[model samples]
Target: MNETKLHDLIEKMTLEEKAAQMSQVVSSFIHKGSSDEKITGPFAGMEVANEDMTGSGSVLGATGADNLRTIQKAYLERSRLGIPLLFMADVIHGYKTVFPVPLALGCTWDPKAVEESAAIAAKESAAAGLHVTFSPMVDLVRDPRWGRVMESTGEDPYLNGVLARALVRGYQGDDLKNDQSKLAACVKHFAAYGAPEGGRDYNTVDMSRRQLMEYYLPAYEAALDEGAELVMTAFNTVEGIPATSNKWLMRDLLRKEMGFDGVLISDWGAVQEAIPHGVAADNRDAALKAVTAGLDIEMMTPCYVQHLKTLVEENVISEALLDEAVLRILKLKNKLGLFENPYRGADTELEETVMLSETHRKAARETAAKSCVLLKNEGVLPLRKSQNVALIGPFAESTDLMGPWSIFGEEKDVVSVRTGMTEKLDTEPAVEKGCDIEAVLPEQLEAAVEAAKQAEVVVLALGEHSEMSGEAGSRTNIKLPDAQLQLVAEVKKLGKPLVTVLFNGRPLDLHGVVDESNAVLEAWYPGTEAGHAVADLLFGDTNPSGKLTMSFPHNVGQVPVYYNSFNTGRPKDQIDPEDRFASKYLDAPNGPLFPFGFGLSYTTFTYSSLALSSEVMEENGTIRVSVNVQNTGAVAGEETVQMYVRDLVGEVVRPVKELKGFSKIHLEPGETKQVVFEVDEESLKYHHSDLTYTCDAGEFIVSVGPDSRNTEEGRFSYSPAGRSGQE
Candidate 1:
């Protein structure tokens, strides 16, 4: 299955046969499930017959070793060239032993944990016979109204880029050809799919090319640099062109510039969507455009199967282009070792042993514990086992902790809050459902109050339902539901110590809950071990170390708030503190409710003595910055030390602050440590207004601290090569 063999196979393929290799269909089309199919998005009204799909090179949504084996065997028998079908699925966060959603995992800021979670997912998926996973969706998102934010790693390009590399390493492992607990990683929704207009899904994205490169494209490039084998096209339009067939995006930026020579697949039905997107006249034109534009696979659509061969025959598109696409597919198959063992990692016995094994669940629990961010703590947490606790709310005993994109996770296997507490506390906590997610009956409210009266402390479990924040789950109002808010208000009247634990997908506006509760914990939809992880954190068994990767807006009006914001002409940090002409919000602060890199821990850390290696740096030379941090409180905890840089003067305006580096370190009481950061030419480079990637000679400021808002600062001058404009 080397290059010689792959070339021979492609040469033997007929035009129709090569076209079939570029088509993909859902598993349901081959093995119909026993239920009324739900067609949610652009995939509705699409149909594929067994005759049309038998030769398809790949199948989506097919799971289980037994099912995949059957489907793959049937496909190879009719494949004409004996090519095995590639089984792919959306193993976004987890496959069976579901972990916290990507957004929640991002809060951990622990690349090791993020990588371990993906490794667990890879093991489970590989045992189920999946060869490729449409995952590590490294889209940088700032707007919470976009339902797909749950699938992203949050807004910062640097953070998203770092996590993107971790995920690819975990999924692909050190060697994809040799690792059985691995799957080919497919970094998805290529080229700025996260920033839709008004935070709406699939809306147009209008931005300058420099903005796209500076803010959006870095994550995808990072994933490719990590050796991801495939890339999936975005469903939205980029610069007035549908991403599925945009030549500038697919060719100039992605291929020629970024040097990504991997396979490119369209998101579900995106090729056919080109017609509705107004770029193509019909299916034939859509197929031609996508193929010529560098797309190698058409997912869940008949556009390629029906028209690709005809387009080639009519000389509308080059036959060599079709062969190139077919060759890429064959090369991937060979790399997977599918040419030797068609059933590469499929083993029914191994599947049962590894799907939800105790070892895997332990990793999930540990990761979930690290992901829970302590938003506000008024000395009410670290609950004593002797106290009588009341666990009240809809999620008290509910097992639906796994959020969207957990396609294979079964609710019956999940542990509930009550179950988790029972295992940790000496006395069984009183549990009562105060209300549904969106409604509170009068009787339910009374029962909750009675339970609170009987207990020494009350723990309120609350959040959006699992269906509220995934694909197409956008919400105009990002506040807690009225029912949950009303329940909090009623419980606050009892004057009992209140601890609120939230389990939503996106960053929510927590004005009501934060005001009512003495403590708040953002426990975003922790998967299989949701209850256990929450219990561990509550009982002082584990320290909360998670920091926010995405900014929590003060309200819905500040939709795209983040740590890195351009310094506008009317600066908010003006010379005159009371200046009314500055850019300021009358009703709310310009910053987020919780800024990026912000989190509270059980212990406190103090920073002092910022030092720099030099006052001036020459081009191509590195500058070292150092700070002293000490844990002053009487407890052990972890702290994320963040570093920010600002170009005081630039050719074009720059953000007030940009996060360049960060480190997560553990400290015991009275422990002191020195944290150092190095800055070089790459750290200073940015996309200029004229689209040139360069760094200007100017004064630069560096800050280091616990978060972006509070930091100790120092300044230096940077001079580029052969430029003496700045002294």
Candidate 2:
């Protein structure tokens, strides 16, 4: 439909119909036999009429072609204007063919693989009759105690921004109306939802505007730059005002400053949450503030349905504002091609053939293999098929490999670790359920120890359960459960070569397991093909190429450790060991156990012959920095070459090092490759105290290495126009 027709249709809508168009309800409220029934359960407090249900503009959590076809037919017949309803769901990681959790996807450092996984997810979701997905969560998280950190990409703004654009492109391809397998990407928790105080979910987020502009807002801008179709508000507060109702944030920043004209929807129940946030008095007040602040749709709440019409009639809010919101919603539905074909891409036959097909499983397996990070190795990995191996722990046979937010995935389709190993080995390895996830009995321990004693090597599969991470899964102590630790201690008594493979959602302390095992692999909740991928890495079919995106702390006390932190006046590395007044921990080192971009392969890589095209860079000029990376080991492998820059002096304090660019290369044994990176004035820009994004003319240190902690350094000067000197 064109703009003229869309406006004509809205002009004929009654006030009640327009209000109903702004309201969204779950599928259960609009399915068959729901018109006469009373709304109860979690929605009992909501006041909705049967007409409101029939006229609802969108449905949440509804799937399947047959089911959605029935609902859409019934809804359009009742809608006075015959506006098609939009089907949306939380298809975060994948639909049926699941992939690794988002944090693990970040570890791969392969944006093309990430994009392919998302494209597969979009194909499956659209086949199941979904039109939109609330995905590509781009919140920058530094605190692992925040349960939702598993949903974010990583800690660095540049990395998060890079992955954010890839996800958006994968979901919403070049032509959304022409591609039926693509979905409209919704970049969410709109402004700073990751920096909750104490690392708790939905807690207070208090930060300066400078901090928000510099760190928390760039990833969101990147998503918008990639042309995301929608934005979802965060559940927490921004500067003491709820994000759902903050006009300065929604209207001024996200709309005027960021230039986003797409539909803005609230996170589930975030509009009414303002009452509890102490900003609104009642649902009426919440509706008034949310709409005034530029929210388009009210999800899973009755604030819009019950009060929006009255507020418009009483002149408390403009009728034009209501029309504008409804227009944006209709514009999206038309962009999805739903106005012409209400059942776009809804085919039951496609669902059967596409949902966990062999093609998708192959992609999932390849991506999962690339996501496993080798934290430690002592020549116990790449085991031969003839060797006797014992696979012991809770996840040996368990199929709970899909982590949280995978609402449509089934455990029956998941591949188990035991199944993968059995298929890889000449003879099946001895598998034992050594202990439950949280508890272990004496008999179980004895059996596990006996199995370890009989085998030539042991592969311990242990970590947190799937429920231990994701939203509302925060924890104060981030160590493995005592029962698993006790099992490790008992098994270590046998002194057999141990390779511990961890299945988790977040970065852990790794105190007991890292020290006790001969080899450690951080296999973070690998999805549908978890077993096959693990087998490929264990049997030397594929090399591990993943690196950590988030830092792993030495202990839980160092909760917010990261690589790009600002250098304090009393820096820990500059002071002597005996200095007590410096910024150093008394009992522990002031750094992470595993730094960002940290990973190890079976083969070793060496960096040498660092070269710079120029010693100084002027405005609008580019400088080429090149380094030679060689595979010095006997085996071939892939390496991620990282480039970082440090401002020697700034108007304000700057980080010791900031990751700017990276390249992933494949090299055979004794092979050498030169990787070059171009740096310009735009690469060194930062938000000043006045919020101007520009670079200062000064001295900078350029470093290239495998990880953040160890690097080869060179110096250069930036000379822009109107600058006095190079510091």
Candidate 3:
């Protein structure tokens, strides 16, 4: 929207109208299984749930298409300023055409696919009548023990930033005012919500300013740069105050410095919870604090509707501060074309036409298949297509295979592994109830043993349930939840070739599984078509090439470890056969079980020596780095050609290596493709000590790889002229 139009809308709002903009609707994850779900959290200020939500409205789940129409109509007609409400829903994995969870999508490491998924989600949710989606969670999660990691993209900020822009672009599209698209994308948990102490939900986050800027804050900035219309505050506190009321974080840092002029929404009553954090006296005070602190929209909290008017009339909050929030909201509505047409994007045909079409399902299937990372394979994978496969585990036929935060996404509609296998097979293989991975039953165990004894190959399905890892479901131990470890050990003792497929949300401590299973696939809640996708890989119909978006720690104590960590002053001797105090762990290795960008295929690929156009290129000069990749394995497969850059010299300490770019490619056996990456000056830019992004003349290492660790050795220097793509 133009500034003049925004200014006009701002001029038109009354005091009450201004207060209404400070509020928004919510759709909580909570459900009673029978009654209409209640909008929980701080929204008690509301009189009741209604079709028209003006005083910081709340969306409770996917209200039917008709109900959404009613809600939109009521808001457009009854609102004091004629401002349309922002209808929101947790369209996390998928709105209707479910795909892999965020953690699994990260494994794909294909930004185009990631962006496409978000775009598909935007199309479906907008069709269903939502104006916003609280998604593309960009928190830098390191601890797999934290359940919310399932919601984040991954651990690396660079990758997160890239994905953030993709999600934002996909969600908002070219223009939010346009019809047939979803609402504004919300990049969440404003600051360091992932680095919580003890990996607990809503725990305190304490870190250096450098860590915040260099790591956690980049994705938020990227989202803003991509024109994301909204930003949601985190539930956790940074330094001391909860992020919702953090002036330094919300105003000084995000607004003033970052120049984000979008509405700031609080996460599910986070504003009022500050009272418990000793930051506010009560809900009334919380309302006063949040708006003044720069949170324009109280997400679930009716803190504003219940108390902000009183606060403003009492002169506790300046009228100007309240107007600031109203102006932002008005600008958003105007941008959404709500002020002009209110129902600009609503379409009955599009809603029914594309919400669950075969095209979307096919995309979901491909995405789900690509997101599975083959963690362990000793040539036992790529099972014969004609073999009689035994699919074992409690969840082999699970109706709730999709992970947490799903919008009532169904399992029956989702193609199960058992079902997918049958559809793909020329002959129907014997399917048996081989005992529940979680359920402890001697009879089922004996039956499973007997089944495994007869089959040539076993596809053991095991992992957390759909509800086990998101939001309020943090875990103390990231290992497989049930006695699945014992079960795997028990099954392995029989020693028939086994391929274990994991259905988890967060990174699990697979120490036991790794040791016993012949081949392992991290198939993190692969949405609706998960079963079919898994079957495709197992039956050798498709080769798995999904890389780990996040680090898989060897153990839980190695929490917070990621690839971009700075080199310690006293570095560990990674090559030492025998050394003490080398910064190496006594019980385990110094690296993750699965590093970022690490994935395996049924086939192998060879990385050629790095060839640069010029090893000594000037900073402004364009240098092309090329590497020839050969598919050495017999089967045809896709490989993610990754590029990592290192500024050997910097004003301050820098990461050992950082992901610059990546591309996905498919190659037949023995086929070679020369891939090229252009690195000018922008790829070498970094924030200086004075807090300005600068490109320095320095030596750099351009590591080409199938994954982070698997790279050819190379050295190059980038001499500065001036950086393009600078902010």
Lowest summed-lDDT stretch of 10 residues in model 1? 32-41
In TM-score terms, candidate 2 sits at 0.98
Colliding pairs, model 1 = none
In model 2, the clashing pairs are none
Computed on alpha carbons, the lDDT of every model, listed in order, comes to 0.88, 0.90, 0.78
Candidate topping lDDT: 2
lDDT of 3 by residue, 1-727 (tens): 5768677766786666666667655432121121223233444544325322344433545444555666566555655655566567677778878888888888887778888888888888777676778887889888888888998889888788888888787787786776458668878989888889888988888887777887789888888898888788999888788899898898999999999988888888687788889999988888877887899887655577777777878888788888777777777767777666665555677878887689988888898888999999988888877777777787777766678877646666788778887786666655655555456677777777777887888878888886678887788888885577767877898888988999998988898898898999899999988888998888778789899988889888887778887777667754465767577678887788889889999889998868988887784687888999999989899999999999876888888889988888999999999999988777887777777776777788988998887788578876555632222
Model 2: per-residue lDDT, tens digit, 1-727?
Answer: 9999999999999888887778877887777532212121245455553334657788888888888888889888877778999988888889999999999999999999999988999999998888999998999999989888989989999999999999999999998888999999999998899999999988999999989998899999999999999999999899889999999999999999999999899987888889889999998999999999999998878888879889988999999998999999999999999998999988899999999999999999999999999999999988888889999999889898888787788899999999999998987898888899899998998899989999999999998898998888898888888888888888898999999999988889899889999999999989999999998998888999999999999998998999999889999778886889999788888899999999999899999998889999987898899999999988889999999999888877789999899999999999999999988887788888888888889899999999999899998999987784433
| lDDT (10s digit) by residue, model 1, range 527-641 | 9999999999998899899988888998999888988998788878764657788888878889999998888988899999999999888978989999999999888999999
What does candidate 3 score on TM? Answer: 0.92
Off by over 4 Å in 2: 33-52, 725-727
